[model samples]
Target: MSDLNKLGLAEARDALRKGDVTSVELTESCLKAIDDADALNAFVHKTPEIALERAKAADARIKEGDAPSMCGLPIGIKDLFCTKGVPSQAASKILEGFKPEYESTVSQQLADAGAVMLGKLNMDEFAMGSSNETSVYGNAVSPWRRGNDDAQLTPGGSSGGSASAVAADLCLAATGTDTGGSIRQPAAFVGITGIKPTYGRCSRWGIVAFASSLDQAGPMTKNVRDAAIMLETMCGHDAKDSTSAELAVPNFEAMLTGDIKGKKIGIPKEYRMDGMPAEIEKLWADGAAMLKDAGAEIVDISLPHTKYALPAYYVIAPAEASSNLARYDGVRYGRRAHLAQGDGITEMYEKTRAEGFGHEVQRRVMIGTYVLSAGFYDAYYNRARRVRTLIKKDFEDVFAAGVDAILTPATPSASFGLGEMTEADPVQMYLNDVFTVTVNLAGLPGVSVPAGLDAQGLPLGLQLIGRPWEEGDLLNTAYALENAAGFVAKPGKWW
Candidate 1:
């Protein structure tokens, strides 16, 4: 138990119940690891005092013999989550000094179940961008490196910091919000497991809004079992969020039998894009082969509308973002720009937004505003909404035809260098979400499991898209894939 920080959530939970380790030990180990790994820039805020106090309380709760499964585990909270008295900036300059007096429902649920919060993690500003470079706290670098190469690599974005922290064992797991591929892409890049549950599965109240319709919070963990444990604790019906589902939260961890027998796994033909890397293609095929070996039938299916997903998502997400971000005026709770004597309210609004938002945020806001404008509403926004309906129908059709799950490559490539895509056309970066945006668009449950490595020995993942509200079954399939892949390769600890 020397490196208690490296224990996964399930592992730590069992150990705490068996009286083998104290919560304070686990918290201290993680705190020390966090302090030593500042080069990764994964954690933007540290809460060692609160963490130690919570750890002690968790230890007492465990001794009472009626503790929950997550009773003594230490985990990281994404900056998007509003933790009371903690800096929850969403990595944007507009919210520089913002600390919430209330806690987000998901974080509150975890706290109520006795999970200790390590700190708030870094993320892309307002959950924009595919890489972590847009964060006000700077980028969160991947713990993984190419074979014998010294170049720094991106940990994917929006949920980049959560993926990095879990992969590097700074915490047992972390919370992640996925608008497009924020959770899954970063998990793939860092060689971990991440799931974006079906829309409305987790409460959205208190999380900084990016895209109201697409945003869902999930877990990033060391393995499928850890993800299952954390996800169960994070989901429930919340009256506070109108979008929250009113269904019963299943015991996701208990459903992990790692048996996918008789399950129909679909391989979407449209996922085979031109110019997709040979390594990715091979990895995807190999994943299908593994699932077939696990007694699951692999069937070829068609999601013909897949080609329109990225563009439609780009239009719709930005439109929602433009509306959601309008509330961050200088008069609000966050940072306000200094005004000159003659500045009117309109000028104040313009100056504050221009100065507060990052470049990517500004770009998306502009795009959103243009699409929502009266003249173009019918042309862009309405058309994208119609396409989104078609996209959702495509998935419903596939599922109605008896497909239990669909498999695709999680990302087109492995972790790229940190500054590699910033100078290129922004569309080059948007292409990174090619394989993942469809899940959000369709409001389906999607999980990324590390399947194999590329030529440079960096991890690549295969995604599983499950039927709506069937995350338990989806996680069972993911557990099967996790066992089949046996992906236990951790980074060599360069940090």
Candidate 2:
């Protein structure tokens, strides 16, 4: 209890239960940490008032002996999730100053369980970028920096703020949405744990949409156990979301027995891409060795369509984004463009979008629109959908052949310095998702666990892809890996 801000979510929960610490004290500690870490720009909006009020109420619930486990927990919410009157811009100017009258189902459920919201963390505009640089406010700097270097680093995006905040100890944990490796990639880059649940495992209602089919909400936490606890609180079948699965909620924490004996973990040979760094390759092999030592059977497998995952994801995600973002054309809500005396509605839309969106978001919107156009719909969008089906089948076939989960490198490299990837070629930036897009394309659950560090001392993560709706078993496997890796390294307080 000496440094309340440094406690992990599980530790803080226990402290609150033992009367060793009060919810209000823990909330204040986190608020102080948030204020001190402003240089990182993790929390775009601070909500100390709402957080303290919720903490007091949570204390009352705990005193009544009827509180849930998450009750009295102080947490950070991603800016993408609508939280009553809080600003929920997905880091885009198009939705500047827009606050929903209601809350997203995921946030509402967390509130119902007595989790206090510290504030909305920043993210890529409309969850479009790999680095958090696309945010309208500015980039969320990673707490981790290269040895003896002052250069700013990315915390991987679009969940960059979530990863940064959790890594910097600004909050116990934070909510993050993954479209194409958003949550897992950022978590991996920051040396924390993040899990992207199976698509539709968490409700999408009220959360800003990027890709209707691929977008899913999950937790970025300090460890796999914390992720298991948080994910249970965030998931449920929502009547408002047609895609939300109708299923019984399982206690994911209860299933983390760390006993993967006889479990078959697949090593997709295609993941060994040519020119991948020696560190990443060694880290992946080390991760597999750890799992093998944990009594899990390591099986060499093939995901035949793995090579097409990135292209298919780019096509499908953008296609869905164009359709979803059409509502933001200087319309009913959000920022509107000024009009000239002779200008008409079309001119207003053109000017508004041009000014509202960032370079990355606009690029994606244009690509999406082009593919969905009548002249190229079949050639681009239709073919991408076909490739998507094949990617899903690749996972289905692997699992059908007794593979419990798939293991691979989370990112091609460790966190890179901000501004390193100039616009010289955008494909270089897109390659960050090479290993992660397959999970989103397959609509399967994937978790990134901090495994090792590179020569520069930056953290590297190993990803574990699980069967759909089998997150409990997946957490168990991740727990085993986490224990074996024993990665407790933290970033020096450069921020």
Candidate 3:
């Protein structure tokens, strides 16, 4: 067998069940790897002690012949997910000392299915930035490199840490949430596979709210099958989230097939925006050609409302974020600063929030509040909602025309330098989500798979979008792409 360091969840679990390995042994290997790779900044909290305990419990269950699908597997939990005693800060200072008393429905589900928790992974503060620099902890350097130079490049965000850790095999797979392009973009940069299931497919009860209407947690892994296994375990209905879909979460693992032989795939013409890099455009065309090579019929399709997606997403996500963040007014459960000598409670709140939140975070709050305010709600927020409906209608129309799925580039380009984006105007940063945000607005399933690489040696990713709740189709197509691309999930140096 390959070194335990490189094994994925299924491989380790199968080895353990057959008595060829022990959970303690696998967990120890991971702990050692994390210990050796401190510069990656992938972990916000490393709980080796608890990880060992959980691994032992998994070994006990296996001994009794009651092993679950995830028995003996270690998975990283994004800091955004609430873990009872773990600091789920969402990489924000306002919640610096905050610890949840309960686990998120998604994390709890994963635990119940027998996946061992490695620790909390890093993210952009409250899951905000496209590059991981918004993190209070610091940027997560990609495990990839262009050549011999070790200049740090972004791992992508707000799930950059999760993608970096999984790609490095610090943990088998990590949970991630996508609001705009958080999960998919990072996975693309790290050369891994990640899925953002149809909105409402995964419950959001204990995942920290960023843009609540757009955020949905999913998985990051080395390959498509692992993504399926993680998704099947964590996705289901939860009464705590009223928006959680009551529809059955399919057995995604059982449904992954390379037999998209007669599938009809749509390539949206609207995605061909001017100024997109030549390499990115070529990657998309190559991806379409691969699908055609695999017996899938590719057709040109128009989602005419695509131009409005980014503008509408910005208005709606910010509007919702403003409302969601109002709960952190320094009184209920987050950090609060002392007031000026003669000031009152209101001033204390103002001081605390001003000191605690980062620049981008503050910007979103202001934009959100502005759009939702009475003076501008109709002009900005409501108009965006109407455009959101149009974006949804475009997808519905295409699906009605017998399109099995839609394919597009995951991001406009490969991972830019970490500081390249952070130094940019905030609107320029928001433009990074241009291709991925519309699917979120429509509440459809989407995924990003490694397609190829740009000349800079950064990996390119292709996204697959499925009709509402059709994650099975999304994973199936990703699997086909993974095989067609012949990509290997290898990190440059970390661990």
lDDT of each: 0.95, 0.94, 0.88
Tens-place lDDT per residue, model 3, 208-237, is 998878999999988898898889988999
As a TM-score, model 2 comes out at: 0.99
TM-score of 1: 0.99
For candidate 1, lDDT tens digit of each residue in 1-495?
A: 899999999889989999999999999999999999999999999999999999999999999998999987999999999999999999999998999999999999999999999999989999997889999999998999999999999999889999999999999999999999999999999999999999999999999999999999999999999999999999999999999999999999899999999999999999999999999999999999999999999999999999999999999999999999999998968988889999999988989898899999999999999999999999999999999999999999999999999999999999899889974589999999999999999999999999999999999999999999999999999999999999999999999
Candidate 1 vs candidate 3, lDDT winner: 1
Question: What total of clashing residue pairs does each candidate reach?
Answer: 0, 0, 0
Identify the superior model by lDDT, candidate 1 or candidate 2: 1
lDDT of prediction 2 = 0.94
Which residue pairs in candidate 3 have backbone atoms (N, alpha carbon, C) closer than 3 angstroms, thus clashing?
Answer: none
lDDT of 2 by residue, 319-437 (tens): 89999998998878899989899999999899999999988888898999999999999999999999999999999999999999999999999999999997788899999999999
Error of model 3, residue 34, in angstroms? 1.0
**Cα-based TM-score, every candidate:** 0.99, 0.99, 0.98
